[model samples]
Target: MAEREWTTADFDYDLPPELIAQEPVPERGTSRLLVVHRTPGTNPPREDLAFADLVGRIPPGDVLVVNSTRVRHARLLGRRPGGGPAEVLLLHPLTGDRWLAMGKPGSALRPGKQVLLGDELAIETLLVRDDGFREVRVVGADAATAIERFGRLPLPPYIARDPDQLDEARYQTVYADREGSVAAPTAGLHFTTELLDAVRARGVEVVALDLEVGPGTFRPVEAEDPRDHAMHEERFEIPDTVATAIAAARGRGAAVWAVGTTVVRALESAGEPDGTVRPGAASTRLMILPGYRFQVVNRLLTNFHLPRSTLLMLVAAFAGHETTMQAYHHAVARRYRFYSYGDAMCLI
Candidate 1:
């Protein structure tokens, strides 16, 4: 028989509105975990466990890789000169006090227009880019200082409430170090410092990479054919230490565990056909669809993604399409929380 053809619709499933997680659990490491095996041609069984049980699940000699990119306070809510509400989300820094940002009321934020972010911080729209983002220059204060003092967390639109003080810490991972990403690598959110220490205690080597997650994370695959969707370029850095650790693990027959899809993308983008990763800083627009071969990331730990999302497609690519869809149905049937700030799944 010929291989089956897959489309964007094949990767989507219905999710109840109530299952969308509105908030994080009271404690970081207390969420539920749904573990599934990636082995094909078998009825995959799920092992329900606590997030804290991760330390006991991984084999001792395996290597765990995490994205340590910190979420930047990039959402600047302000008012226009004429007193209309305005919002600008900083996407990338271009030069001194200037950025490529997404501005609301796009028609109004043309060149020379200004938005007052705070009493002393304002942004003047310069030029609109080919991609529809606006080049803006910060005035009245240093861009970094202005963002730190007045910017709010760029919470996902699905979260109905405004970002509160709790979100300031809960939205980020304990190990977040490099300050660049507009969004958090949420799979890392389930790990507490104590849990990380415990994993290390079990002889698993933990390493870090930085992938400056872009706003595209919130975008869904709009193309009818999944392969036609263009991925946003994300800047990532794989340090010498991480490459060395993964190499060492591979040499010893240990599995390489990617903490989130972002890590998987980075590793696979730099991966050699032999499963060895090249270490360096780079940007990737590589999209992993159902038929794409994965050279790295033997194991994956990730959150339940949105319907019609590239994240979901990548999961389908790593785990089998049938297995992934079945697991999603199981998760929904079992009332597992979904999306960012939701429960996680471990695919082995």
Candidate 2:
């Protein structure tokens, strides 16, 4: 039989708007979990459980990799020169208080002018990008400090509401400590300190990696051929301890579960040619489509993604394409929440 050609449309599904999750569940461990068995012809194919039941789903002594990059308050609402409304979303931090960010209505923001975030925090526009991003220099205060004072949580656009006070804690994972990412690793958001303690009590090996997610994560693949879409390079680091654990687990024939798409990207990007994980700090632009082989990440735990998104393609790459499509249809039929604040699907 001849192999099939895959396009961006081949990876999409219809999701009703009401299923989009606007807020996180009050309890972190209370979200619904849909477990998909990867084997062909498995009876029932899907199992529904609470997020807290994850301890039983994972095999004992297996390695679980999580991304610990914290979600920063990256969306700044400010004013342009002459009092026009302006918005800035910090993308990546550069040296000496400069940052790469996307400026709203960027067409009119001149390079030499400044955007005022607060009474003392101002950003001087250094470069105006044709793609709607701006290179700005934080004039007086540092980027981190300014964002902490004037920025809101940079939630995905699908979530159509202002963030509430609870979002301050709910948007971040319990283990998130390193400050870098603009978006939360949504899959890890389901774990509570108590739940993590339970996971450890079950003899699971937990490892941490850092993948600094950028604004490009939310961009849709617009090319006619999905292969032509370019992925943005996000910085990542797999510490030596995590790398050692992953190598040992692989040697013993144990599985490694990546907590989110970001972790999947990081582990796969850092995989050695011999199939073992290596420790290092670097950036990755690796894009996983349907035909791309995964070098690491034996199992995947991820939130439902937007239709036709790169994230959806990555999920399809890990799970079989047909299997993932069926799972999405099932999730929709059951009215499971969708997108960043959505329910989870664990493929094993």
Q: Highest TM-score, which number? A: 1
In angstroms, the error of model 1 at 134 is 1.7
Clashes of each: 0, 0
Candidate 2 positional error at 91, Å:
1.5
TM-score (all chains, Cα) for each model: 0.97, 0.96
lDDT of each structure?
0.91, 0.87
**Alpha carbon deviation, residue 263, candidate 2 (Å):** 0.4
Candidate 2 RMSD computed on C-alpha atoms after optimal superposition onto the true structure? 1.4
RMSD to the true structure for each prediction, in A, is 1.3, 1.4
> Model 1, range 1-348, lDDT digits (tens) per residue?
776778989988999999999999999999999998887654547877888988899999999999999999999989988889998888889876678889798866788999887687788999987878889988987788778887889999899999999999999999999888889899999999999999999999999999999988889988998778878889999999999998888899999999999999999999988788999999999898888889978999999999999899899999989889999999999999999999999999
Best by lDDT: 1
Clashing pairs in 2: none
